[model samples]
Target: MTAARVGVVTFPGTLDDQDAARAVRLAGGEAVPLWHADHDLKGVDAVFLPGGFSYGDYLRCGAISRFAPLMDELIPAARAGLPVLGTCNGFQILCEAHLLPGALTRNASLHYVCRDQRVAVESASTAWTGDFTVGQEIVLPVKHGEGRYVASEETLDALEANGQIVFRYAGGNPNGAMRDIAGISNEAGNVVGLMPHPEHAVEDLVGAPSTDGRGFFTSILSKLVNA
Candidate 1:
């Protein structure tokens, strides 16, 4: 009856590692600190890549961090169904790592946006979103400059066919993401990436009074317990 152990990876320039770990703990899981340079996963049940400007956003948003030593282990583990969740810059890293398909590009408006966004859960079968119901709308904070999602038409069709599209902007497409996509999961539904910071919305005393983000952490813990 031990708590589920969730690893929160911290890449250089990562700004949300502590917040992500706090979310894990608030969800009743044990948060394991993981470094970008570490080659091992430390036996955690699942891994989370928090939002940040890794590698100082050099080259591209997540280009450099994708090759981090820890990613060497993470990539394989995620592919093998280890359950991975990436938010914001972490989402960019997931795409760069090819853990999830599609890519996050510069916002269509060419402006950095930071706000509480309403998104609908398009697919809840993913490990990180199982607690949510399909089409349920929730509010999460999004802060990023390159948050627009782009993919080929064929890829978009396939993602739709496979139910890989996880979340979509509810009211309007803030960043002009293709098809209003805000988040998506891999084919196996074990790995997910999103351009919003769910960790930032988990506490009521913080900026927003909504705790909608807590489900992301709890959902994974539930999946681990059931496994």
Candidate 2:
């Protein structure tokens, strides 16, 4: 059987495309490179937006990249039920594009934090989180200055009621995000965005504290294969 084709979108300043691609391959999927300036998806089964300072985070993290040519296609597809996963800077893009609710902001301490953080999976029903179980804890790398997530109280209540909150800071709230939110999914559960760098924690050989991040890639492959 052919491996699932997962497109890894690369914006001008994307820094984790290669790592994301490698994680896809390791999860038994083919990683297709997607250029931000292009109009094609190359028939990928799913899309991944990796971490980085897109457009050098000029106006704001993910602000400029939100209007990239590729997003023109991605936004509709995501709304039409194509599964999408965005991490770190990619998370910011998802918000800026209005694909997901809430926005990321500067850490309360006004500092960049890079660490192996523990997150508890609160909901594993989403396409990218299916390999996990509710309450499962995993360690993933998180590095960002503007990573705090903020949303209206009503939005937060609705997300919680709908089980759209996927992950929460387990050990500590590194960014002072509201309700310790580490990740969340859209109302349809197909699009997910998080502030962690899962691509960086997919392998043990790279000195990652845990290979737990591999589940994100594998889960998407399973979703595509089953569908």
Candidate 3:
């Protein structure tokens, strides 16, 4: 079988591109590097927008990145059912692009947070979470100053009703995000965005005791293979 090719996008100030690519490779997939200024996607099977302070987080996180040339191609592809996973600032970008609902704002304490966070998988049917079981608990690192997820009441209701709320912070709400939403997926379930850094936790040798993050990459591989 041919290895599924997953693209890891690198925008200026993107800190986690290499890690995301490595995660893909470790998951038995080919990792394709993508640049924010580039307009092409290299025909990859899936796309990952890793955590970062793109454009230096100047005009709000992911505000400028939403207009990157790379997004022009990515947005359409995602809407057309290409699997897309956005982590941390990437999560902010998805919302800025309107591909995913809600916005990430400053942490309620107005401080940067870095910790291993516990999250419950609320929806395992999405492309990036198929390896997880619904109600499963996993630990992933969360590092960001603006990771608070917020949305309109109507949107939150719709997400809950449609099972689009993919992950919720467990134990405690680290960012004070509304309803403890750590991650969410689109109505079609192909596009997902989250504040946790799964790529950073893919390997046990990297100081992450658990390889819970590997599932995100492997889940996509399974989806591609099955499709």
Error of 3 at 24 (Å): 0.2
Judging by lDDT, tell me the better candidate of 2 and 3. Answer: 3
lDDT of 2 by residue, 1-227 (tens): 89999999999889999999999999899999999999998888999999999888899999999999999999999999999999999999999999999999999889999999999999999999999999999999899999999999999999999999999998999999999999999999999999998888888898368989999988999999989
Write one digit per residue (lDDT tens) for candidate 3, span 17-77.
9999999999999999999999999999999999989999999999999999999999999
Ten consecutive residues with minimal summed lDDT in candidate 1? 201-210
Off by over 4 Å in 3: none
Q: For residues 1-227, write the lDDT of model 1, one tens digit per residue.
A: 99999999998899999999999999999999999999999999999999989988999999999999999999999999899999999999999999988899999999999888999999988899989999799999989999999999999999999999999998878899999999999999999999989999888799375789999999999999989
Q: Where does the lowest 10-residue lDDT sum fall in candidate 2?
A: 200-209
| CA lDDT for candidate 2 | 0.94
How close is every model to the real structure, measured as TM-score? 0.98, 0.98, 0.99
> Cα deviation in Å at residue 178, candidate 1?
0.2
- Quick one: ranking by lDDT, best first? 3, 2, 1
- lDDT against true structure, model 1: 0.94
